[model samples]
Target: MLHPSLAFEKGVPSDATAIPMPPPAPPPRPVDLPGVAPAASTGETPRPPERPAELSRSAPAGPDAARPAQTVKEDGKAGPSDEAAKAGETVKPTASGEIPVPPPRPADLSGSPLAVTVAPLDDSACRARLERLGARFEALPAISNGQCGAARPLKLTALADEIALTPPATLVCETAEALARWTTEAQVAATRDLGQPLKSLSIGTSYECRGQNHDPDAKLSEHSFANGVDVMAFGFAGRATISVMPATEGTPEATFLTAVRGRACDFFRTVLGPGSDAAHANHLHLDERQRNAGHRLCQ
Candidate 1:
């Protein structure tokens, strides 16, 4: 028994002397992919790009790396600016395949001083004939400054609507003379034919030399601009007739108005008569804007 116990003690000493094994070599790290090393991830456990998008291998990650890392081709090319590539919409290039340009602004319509176009030559012979006919003006002045740039033009248009007369601006002087002449002839002829002896030819209105339709603080009227005029009527035999919008049916007051209005077409650019409108029911509306612009015959 004593011998047996001694032998067991000897066996353990041999095993105790044996060398220990190294830890299992870590599984060889999986091979690294070509480029897509995980980007500087803002850690949300990256959704692992719907596709592990691979950019141009030649174009590496850098300042001039075409575009943002996540972005693909824009319009089949690489660029910055949102305009270069709209988000939810397709950019249709022009027929020439050029980028579309914006339209010109209203400010661009302003004529340049250096490129100003001189007005066409004036007709001297016509001017002389008009001078003999008591022609009053060479050219009416342009709109005043206080008036709105846009609104003042409307005044010119309104006057045109009144006259039943649309003549070239160059012929406006002759047009005015003709207007005055016809008005004179009508009153005279009406006096002769209607046996309406002359009394007083009152002026209900005339060119005021102001802006159009604007009676600003009663400070200025389009008439004041000399762009408009108003006529009250002609005096006839026995009675002074308020002829413009004469409500009296079939009388010389009415006939004279009718004839004058009919003839007015030949004079003014526009013509408003007694039957034309309520505002003009008391007077004639006349002016020259443009031939065939907007002619309203307001009584």
Candidate 2:
């Protein structure tokens, strides 16, 4: 029943006043990520978002990039980190990319210069060596008279293993022991090889109280102290005799004598034979005369 111009829209109340709706909520404001610049402030050019500080610190860098600086203490000195010290590890800066090496340890010597020990010399060692060679002799009183003396003398009555002598001789124990070894190991062995088993030895001179070659004015001979002995000839079981002389050369007897004389140097300090001098042209002379530096006189 209202005029056309004044008629309300279909469901509006006739008495209601006109009300304007609030403007549509402002479009949601754009959210800005951390470290990102606002779009309005930066104009229309879209920029890549910046990473956070923690992410940047963890990211790996290129080989040519500068390394992070080491942290210095407040006292102004740079040192290893606490974790590295606790782990017993050190980090050293490379110089020209070269690695560092530690020095080698020294060897332990235990206060000794040599690895082995040597036993001290004993006085009875000589007698022990002689007795082990099966020599038969009685110990005699020592003789001493003005540069002419025999210490620990023994009356040597036999040579090789019970082989008796035609006349027993006297000599110092050292010389007697040497003679015994040379006779058994050298002379007897060589003669037996020549088909002559010796039974007895002929005595020449032993314990002579004289100078060299019986010269009264010369220096005392080794014989004056019962240290030298002479072997004139070797007697076999059937009364066979082989004299030690150059005349017997080229014969088995001469070979036997030469073999024995050469080996005597091993046992005796001095060995004299037919070619030595006119005085020793007929017999072999053996003695134990201590020389400097154990130099044996084998003539």
Candidate 3:
């Protein structure tokens, strides 16, 4: 009953009211976007799609261009700071978009304080003290033998009250002061126990460049620095000489020797005597060597 031309134009029979277009696939339900609410559930109006990352990046850059989004973690947290810090390297970008290089690490200067060279201290005040102690001395040229040396060595010939030092001795001002002080004690002991005045001291070693106890492999002796002395015997003005050997236990020589040796510890940091060890069995070893906590070695 429908005309052919009309049927062709309408693409349906005239008796049919309409030709159904395959139901437009229920306009594909929109997928959920992160951090954004769905229009149907949130009562919000639909909007255009966001600009793609690729399009945003391809756009011409300007001073007002948006910065790239920070990377997100698996748990949706923000990433690290703009400057990425790594071992020995720090990466940061400048306004011109160039990454800057980090500074170099400092070199190690870790070593012993003793290894560093230092200026010697002025010895004027020490020399002044020695003069006040009634010590007769004259300065000698500096002694330099590798690690064995003295900045200011003195040639000491006499101590307080003119108690002579036989054959003179090489010493620093400090050791000379200690020797002078100890000699006064020995003079007192000699007058009290030996019934005579102290006259001279028979010197043994002073300022020797050698190790302790004459051992080449041992630690350097205080004498290496002109800081030690060795007394071989004591000569009195009227009485017979008293050697540093062990005397009779009940004799006045023993009493005088004991008194002098015990008092030497007051002025010297180290005092070794005839009974201390075999190395010091025949004499007294006195020194001004420094020690920790002001400790002394008296044996």
Candidate models: Cα lDDT each:
0.48, 0.71, 0.84
Top-down TM-score ranking: 3, 2, 1
Clashing pairs in 3: none
Alpha-carbon TM-score of each model against the true structure: 0.41, 0.55, 0.62
Q: Is candidate 1 or 2 superior in TM-score?
A: 2
On the 0 to 100 scale, the lDDT of residue 21 in model 2 is 69
Off by over 4 Å in 3: 1-117
Give model 2's TM-score versus the native structure.
0.55
**26: Cα error in model 2, Å:** 99
> Candidate 2, residues 116-152: lDDT per residue as tens digits?
8444234266666666776666767777787787766
Model 3 worst lDDT run, 10 consecutive residues: 81-90
Maximum-TM-score candidate? 3
lDDT of 3 by residue, 165-200 (tens): 998999998889889888988988988898899999
